[model samples]
Target chain A: MDEIIRINHITKEFRVPDRHEGLRGSIRDLFSRSYHTVHAVDDISISIAQGEIVGYLGPNGAGKSTTIKMMAGVLEPTSGEILVNGCVPYKNRTRNAQNIGVVFGQRSQLWWALPLVESFRLLKDIYQITDAQYDEMLALYRSLVDIEPLLHKPVRQMSLGQRTLSDILAAFLHDPKIVFLDEPTIGLDVSMKAKIRTLIHELNRRKNTTVILTTHDMGDVDALCRRIVIIDKGKMLYDNDIEHLKKFFGAYRTLKLRVKGDLSEQAKRIAAELPECSVSANENWISVLVNEDKQKVISVLSQLQKSYDIRDMQLEEISSEDVIKRIYEGGVV
Target chain B: MKRKGFRFYLRIYFKILAQDLKSKMSYRADFIISTVGMIFTNIAGFVSFWIMFRNFPSISGYSYHEMLFLYGFSLLSVTPTQCMLDNNWNLRQQVYSGDFIKYCFRPINLFFYYESEIFDAKGLGQLAFGIGTLVYAWAKLGLAVTPLAVLKLLVFLAGASFVMAALQTAAAASCFWIENSFYVLDLAFRFRDYAKYPITIFSPVFRFIFTYIIPIAFIAYYPGMMVLRPSEVSLLSWLSPLIGAVFFYLAYRFWMYGASKFNSTGS
Candidate 1:
């Protein structure tokens, strides 16, 4: 893989003015203003290679946007260095913008009143895209995304899912070398999520477009990302392949057991017997966290079966929320 | 992406402007009502002057018709700023709503794209009224109407309008820091209407501040002086083109500086 992006010790500090409340405070601020530094992106460094689809994951306000802004040339880092395709993004904005595309799920770049394809044509002009290239990209986008009915509809009238698909099309129509998708599938249904995931994968595979995706949706990470960078509190927690991460914190399973009667006694018994397992009782279900020790699950279930008539037993994979907590707790590196 | 020429970006701006006009047309009744309302607003300014003239011929040395020329000339001078650049008047709303993010992400120039976002055909009424007033005032003044003088007036109005537009843009850019600067803009415009009258009518202190400190006078007063009182127009009036160009650059630079520090309050 060819290195296309190199960020070294980049930190973005915002001097947020700490203004007091009320008219008196505002007057005071005029005379003696005060500000506090918010380290939105603490000193963090990561190099990305061409054609690599990396998931940039973090909780809200964990600095995902700050980093994206820096990379996209929308912002400048307070300290440190960043180079995209051999040029500093903020220093050479137009040059860097030429090779990079960005899709912001919260804000639409599509003209609100224009038909979706008109926005695409407007972008075609902006990018100086040739007719052949435009047709080629349109064909590829059409095959991947089912936005045919939406192409003629105004952006303001389109559903979130349709708009998202259209936004994705506009972002990639220029055939940018790199694409940054910020929460690309947010506020979409399961089917929409799957469609977008397929589109993302197809874009990367067909065009070899490097992608940096920032999303709270784990299904996106699971569906498309081979590697992911996890950030917490303005610092990198883990930067590695998904396989390694899953193996390090080996895929834990959850057993959701519903009992015939009052199940707290048996749940307590299982807790006592399998001390390593995490056990919790909520409503009618007793969710038992079982990992590594296969026999522990069997021993616990047999004990539960003995105590009460086994009404139902469901085994599930560890959830995204739990995985994020584990990363925050430094359980994986 | 391929490297596009200047024409390419102009086409993009045209497309964006077309989209804006179409969007404005979406609410047909609102468009018509707003157009009528704008005409009435423009007419009201003249009406206030007309009512005042009914009581007294003029406030200072000038007469009622001369004041009309002054006021109409000022309106023509501000057409590009207040009318075409109307979006700058409400840019804080866009900043607060995070629509500024569109320009940030696009490959086109931010300033141009931002301006294009609001083509503002709603200004048509004002523009028509302004041109009509200027023609009426010019004919009423009954000057020699030399082509050279006409050319000079056009040039002055053009340069002054550019300055006005630049000032409006600078005000909008301040929102990057102040977050909500419509109040600040309102305050600026409260003093702005005074330019519609002769600056000489005010105290010397106000005259100096509006001329040198804020330079609001240059937008209409000084330029209008070129036609109204050419002898009083000093050698500095020659620098109108230079001042307009430089000031426009500085104002746009100020906008870019603010945008650089912009921590997008994305909702």
Candidate 2:
């Protein structure tokens, strides 16, 4: 519950040269170059505490990376203040870096051609980590995951999942007070994602390490984060626990049907019969959204069954993914 | 974290350099071929000097063998920069690709981390060729082989290498602001060719720029003078170590400025 990160009205703006299109435009631009400002991160503020895994959620080009970069001391905010571990991140980057770890997905921090442990040793030296701390962390890692087989495997040969897992472990090796993971599970498989999520959860629990993860995968958020902060167009839209966010969209129920016949026709019939429900089809499943408050899901399902020979049907509650999708689609803040 | 002492960083530097060398050795054939190719490249430069000497024996009041000494000294002085700081040559590409942000994540000096990422094996070839030429020139010119003289040569080589590394680092750091700083580094490297000959051959203005502005003349020209013509050498020529330290400090400051102003590329 102790405050470890305090961001107050932080804003990061970038001035980019206005480039011209054609050769003549380019030549004209060379003579009188113009520029425009991009508000990559608008005035946003959030306070994070120790031992909390908060999901920093945003769409592509939604300034997720820009915000994470500012928090990591990679970029200085243009306005307002940010204090991590009682120091301004950009002002005291090296000192802040000692207490924080970062994993920028799609970019491996490990030595490309060296064994995984070599990068770890170099990091140990870089962080000036004591031998006891290093060995203890190693022991914890070995217990949680089967990384012994990977200790000597070169980073270049590892699959994407292995590399990402190693990167996450490396970030936590220093026992940093906070770790910023930008899309850590971005391109990982379900099992790999589960493995990484478990690792992050265990580390946060055991070491009391704060975790700030930016990811589009709702599964990642659902599995690891208790609190979720959603941003769009450089603005913070929502910040609360996942349960509260789900409560906001509690009126809707997803009715999934495993149909054997014409999916589109069945979808059309369902939509026509139930004017209040929103319907969509993919492959052999027709998913119809029913507002439970407006009409019970049972009534909607029974009504559709009378018209079409629905092979099978089931109902699902609105997930965090649905809430986020609705928010991104301009539903509500 | 509090800043550690010099010895701590020095230890990390060698550790990372060893790791880098081990990684480079993974592609054994590529390493061997590139190292050999690097030596051949220097040999090709020497062969050009040989052909020119064959025609005129000397171009600027210096004999063929003396120019060899100058060329050998220039190569030896630059080996440190070539071998250690070769990663800077890729700074522009890394910046464009957003790979430069990797340095920001580490709890180490950005410039040191960037430079320590690689140790160019090709510099070994340059070192081998430079030593070979220096020994050959030493025997031919009948220069004294005193222990003090050898020690002094090493001190001068260290200073000259620092100057060259400083210049290259400063040029490469400009990539943080400019679109392509390799062009600026290339321009700096063109001045390196001037160090292969005596500063006396150039006009006074060129001599001034090489000595004052760029200070590349200290790399080989002035230091060569101290070894070849000790009586003719002035007091200024002996300031290679001081000049190197000053230029390195300035360049490091310049690099820090660029790093502060760096606008990382989009993710």
Please compute DockQ, using alpha carbons, for every candidate against the native two-chain complex.
Answer: 0.52, 0.56
Chain A TM-score of each model, in the order shown? 0.89, 0.89
**lDDT of candidate 2 over A1-333, digit per residue (tens):** 799999999888888889989999999888997889888889999999999999998878889988888888878898989999899988887888899999989898887888999999999999989999999999999999999878999999999999999999999999999999989998888899999999999999999999999987878888998999988888888888878776667788899997768898778877887888899998868999988889998888777677677788778877655776788787564
Worst 10 residues of 1 chain B by lDDT: B258-267
Candidate 1, clashing residue pairs?
none
Candidate 2 chain B weakest ten by summed lDDT: B258-267
| Over 4 Å off, model 1 | A18-34, A256-270, A280-286, A296-299, A305-315, B1-9, B264-267
lDDT of 1 by residue, A1-333 (tens): 789899999988787778999999999988998888888889899999999999999888889988988888888888999999989988878778889988888688888888888788888877878999999998887787666899889999988988888888788889998999999999999998999899989999999999999998888999999999988778888899989888855647888998876678767866887777888887788888888545566766786687568788898777766788877876566
How large is the interface RMSD of each prediction?
2.8, 1.9
Best by lDDT: 2
> Per-residue lDDT of B1-267 in model 1, one digit per residue for the tens?
455578767777777777777767888998899888888888898898789889988778887777877787777777777656676776787777766666787666777767776666756776787788778877887865899889989888887777777677777788988966987677666666887777778899998888777777777777877877787787656667568778888988988777766643323
The docking category that best describes candidate 1 is: medium
Which residues of candidate 2, in runs, are more than 4 Å off?
A250-275, A278-288, A296-298, A301-322, A328-333, B146-148, B202-215, B234-240, B264-267
Docking class of 2: medium
Assess candidate 1 and give its lDDT: 0.81
lDDT for residue A55 in candidate 2, whole number 0-100: 96
